[model samples]
Target: MHRKTIVDVGTDHGLLAIGLALTGKFQKVIGVDVSQQALENGALSLLSQIESRRKGIDPQKAALDVPVEFRHGDGLKALEEGEADIVCMAGMGVSTLLQILEQDHDALTSDLNRRQYTDLILQPTNSKPRNLMFLYKSLQDSGWELRNERIVKLSSRWYVTSHFTRPQSNIPVTALIEDGAMKIPGSTLDCTLSDSDPMRQDLEEYCRHHSQWIRKDSEYGRMDLLEEVWLERFGNDR
Candidate 1:
């Protein structure tokens, strides 16, 4: 069994970390941010959340003593080698996320990574298909296999949250990437949900330009379509 610890890198308000802690699935949650101010704010939020939960009627929820800590540092510099089983980098751009990983490759790309395995929850704020494709391609080339994928349109910006983990030795890297484009299933681009709004119009143009080369296949190219849930996933259902 593995240690059920999570390290939230670039955790802005620690909402995701707090939510994970509340689920009681993870034993510990660490919110790491570059800005000290952000850490302070998240600490306050965590404190307030705990206090509020303590006042609730659900004794079990209130009694949940999941530890949530905040650290101040850029990217993965605040993290030690194999410090957590899961690392989340959300609400960031594709380029910024890649830069962070590139800056601290050894810590994440260790032999321990293959043996112990680490889950990475990456949600990029970038809307351009080309950039997202680049990030996806980079992850594959670096031996991170996709476990889950989500496409969300939050307040005019489309976000793709890719959950990845250590590559299984048997499976080969993705061959879908071709001619700067591949197919991304269950997306506005794939399903043709294009509208005429100015922002979406711009995104639509880019999607059209790279439609052939930017492929984010459905849940690792699963055969059965789970249209009931709006997530595009791969690997295990969890």
Candidate 2:
């Protein structure tokens, strides 16, 4: 419930933006999409939500104080510099997400009004090693530091939601790649295997799946670094 301004990139039907606005947490929620029809649909959906609230159809009690706006554009094209303190991109492939982040980097470096620190929330639908590695390297390269991450299992599929921030420049891309490939220590692995924390358990499952998928695909480059990232977060010694 932070009073931050959020811009949802590739916001199809505006569900995320509208939902956030309904929470009365953000100062503004802007849904940006490439399609006009999606914007129209999202507007209608938001209107319906507002109508429901007016009629007391929905009972939660949090008044919708945030203003939700919809813009039509690709990636960050619809957003002006410094307009949003947070940017969210979800339900898209890693490649598309990378493109959007790259564009944001370019904009940030070029624009005078771009904020010094803008949070990036990403949910990449695909779990390829190459994709994951690319995301990792790209974030560091673009000056965004990985602050937190979570893995969720849904419908027998694994999805990762990562939170990043534009912190001070970090390790080199090659070093990051190496970090992700580093193997988890045996002791750390044992601890995570038996940890009762749900997030830790989900991470263990995510590692198992990610390791298997990457190995099956013969994407050997990221194996060690990926495991290293896991250990860095959940390892007993860290």
Candidate 3:
């Protein structure tokens, strides 16, 4: 795996940061948290782990390693400009993630090369499906384009990772948006297939799921728009 600079936000115990550093996945890891005591305790724990590892290896065989830093501050507040390439915000809620984005939006937009910041890996707790949509939309509006997504099943809940990049103007139109969403003007569709065919099966499947969710009065109103799009695309097919 390629080495990358990693910043893990809300790093409580610093295990992930230490693990990444030990595995050589990252040259350096900065664990950021708002609580001073948490940072102090986490740093102590991380240092102990690093020392334990060093004791097992002969000095001649040991590789020089970068020390992990623990910073006490709000999300990205203590981080210097262009300090890291990957930002991992885990063990936080969607609302907290949005708040972080709002607070750091200007700094992130101005200092970082949006194209080079390869990923925003969020593992949000207490997130509704629509909150995910809202997050996706907000990133799009901020000039970041999602590149990949994955849903991992954890012991109790699902964790999602969304990797993004700054959109290139020359990329195909449909590649810029979500599967069931609309594209912005001047975006070119990447597919050679007819437009009608792209959403034919999607509409049918969405309707089936929407009807089920609607019957239960789920709080996700975006499903209504999905159902509407499905109906508009395949009215008589049902």
The 0-to-1 C-alpha lDDT of every candidate, in the order given, reads 0.61, 0.65, 0.59
Q: Write the per-residue lDDT of candidate 2 for residues 1-238, one digit (tens) a residue.
A: 5588988889887788788887878888888889889777776567566757765854654344437888888867677667788888899998888777656555433331255337888888885444665676666655566666666678977777777776565456666556553222222334444466566665666656555655554455545654445434543322
Report per-prediction Cα RMSD to one decimal.
Answer: 10.1, 5.4, 7.4
Worst 10 residues of 2 by lDDT: 181-190
Q: Over the stretch 112-179, how does candidate 3's per-residue lDDT look in tens digits?
A: 45325666776677433445555665566555666655444446454555665654433322344445
lDDT score for residue 192 of model 1: 41
* Candidate 3 error regions (>4 Å): 1-3, 60-67, 105-118, 167-215, 218-238
State TM-scores per candidate: 0.65, 0.74, 0.67
**1-238, model 1: which lDDT tens digit per residue?**
4448888878887788777776767888888888988767766566676757676756665434756777888867777766777778888888888888767456435543633547778887765544665676666655666666555555655666677777544222244343312234224233343355444554444444333222344335532222211233222122
Model 2, residue 42: C-alpha shift (Å): 3.3
Best by lDDT: 2
In TM-score terms, candidate 2 sits at 0.74
What is the alpha-carbon lDDT of model 1 when measured against the actual structure? Answer: 0.61
Reference-based lDDT, residue 103, model 2: 66
**Which residue segments of model 2 deviate by more than 4 Å?**
55-66, 104-117, 176-194, 219-238
Best by TM-score: 2
- Weakest lDDT window of 10 consecutive positions for candidate 1: 227-236
